[model samples]
Target: MSPVAAPAAGPSATPSADRVADVRALSDHLPRFFRLVQALKQAAGVDGRDRAALVLLFPLVRVGPLRQSALAELVHADPSTVSRHVAALVEQGLVQRVADETDGRATRLLVTDAGRAAAERLREERTAHLAAVTAGWSDDDLAVLTELFGRLLDDLTAALPADSRPAFPAPREKP
Candidate 1:
């Protein structure tokens, strides 16, 4: 990439061509960010199969033992699709199904202890990877990046309006 021009240095400086160029340069960083996240996920030991398993397991871990219909809804996947993934996870001993006490005919899916361990390992790996990558970053630099990210997300969320947000709602209170 061509070098971006430096921003004007003045107490009352307004946006300049150089500042525009810099902002444009920053916009191009998103692909790099995506690649980094993908690499981090791989380093966390998530493969194609395990990635799918993680998608299915996340809801179980978050919402506890839930019915297949509820799990599917939480995951935003069709019941059959979630069922197949859950079946594979169950066979692998990463998830378990228990008879629902409230409804004997229904089964509730729960992540096994092994599954929690896997999730924890993945979390640790991701945290360590991010820490190592940002170890040399100054506090101000990190803070500015964090703030920029928050602003970007705010802009995106504003564009979507309330109805278009992800279907996942806040956890409901149990009786």
Candidate 2:
């Protein structure tokens, strides 16, 4: 089997022209990646929730309870849109509303046991799908892809303004 080709040099390693091309390539590819993942999720049955609702469940599962406003910011969605998603999730018994421990007047959304189960199933299905797709990939290639993607996510998160950043746990430091 042929080895996978390395990605083009990124901004730090490339000339300005190459960097611009690389950035443009990334911009062009991200939407395709998003659509592919969305399609995969849809095929995985997504627990009967719409994509937006399932997306909201992820942050809640990963980061624990959050205020609706905070969840909206984390998902980079409008508060009203998130509110609608939350309402649907709540109605499905996948999410619950709880009073904020720190604020008497405020409420937070928590995932239900059923929600956690669904999230776990979704994760497993996605992992299986990815594994099947990459079944021919070598371990080193998979490692490199995982490392680069994690770095990209960390860099993107860091580039956001401090106040605009999500309330999720901080990225881990490389040893």
- Location of the lowest summed lDDT over 10 successive residues in candidate 2: 1-10
Residue 75 alpha-carbon offset, candidate 1, angstroms: 2.8
- Model 1, range 85-107, lDDT digits (tens) per residue? 88888888888989999999999
Per-prediction RMSD in angstroms? Answer: 7.3, 4.5
Backbone clashes in model 2, listed as residue pairs? none
Query: Could you tell me the TM-score of candidate 2?
Result: 0.76
Error of 2 at 3 (Å): 12
Instruction: List residue ranges in candidate 2 displaced over 4 A.
Output: 1-24, 41-49, 169-175
lDDT of 1 at 148: 60
lDDT of 2 by residue, 38-129 (tens): 77666766553576686678899888899999888887888888898899889989999999999999999999999988778766877787
Which runs in model 1 stand beyond 4 Å of their true positions?
A: 1-28, 39-46, 147-175
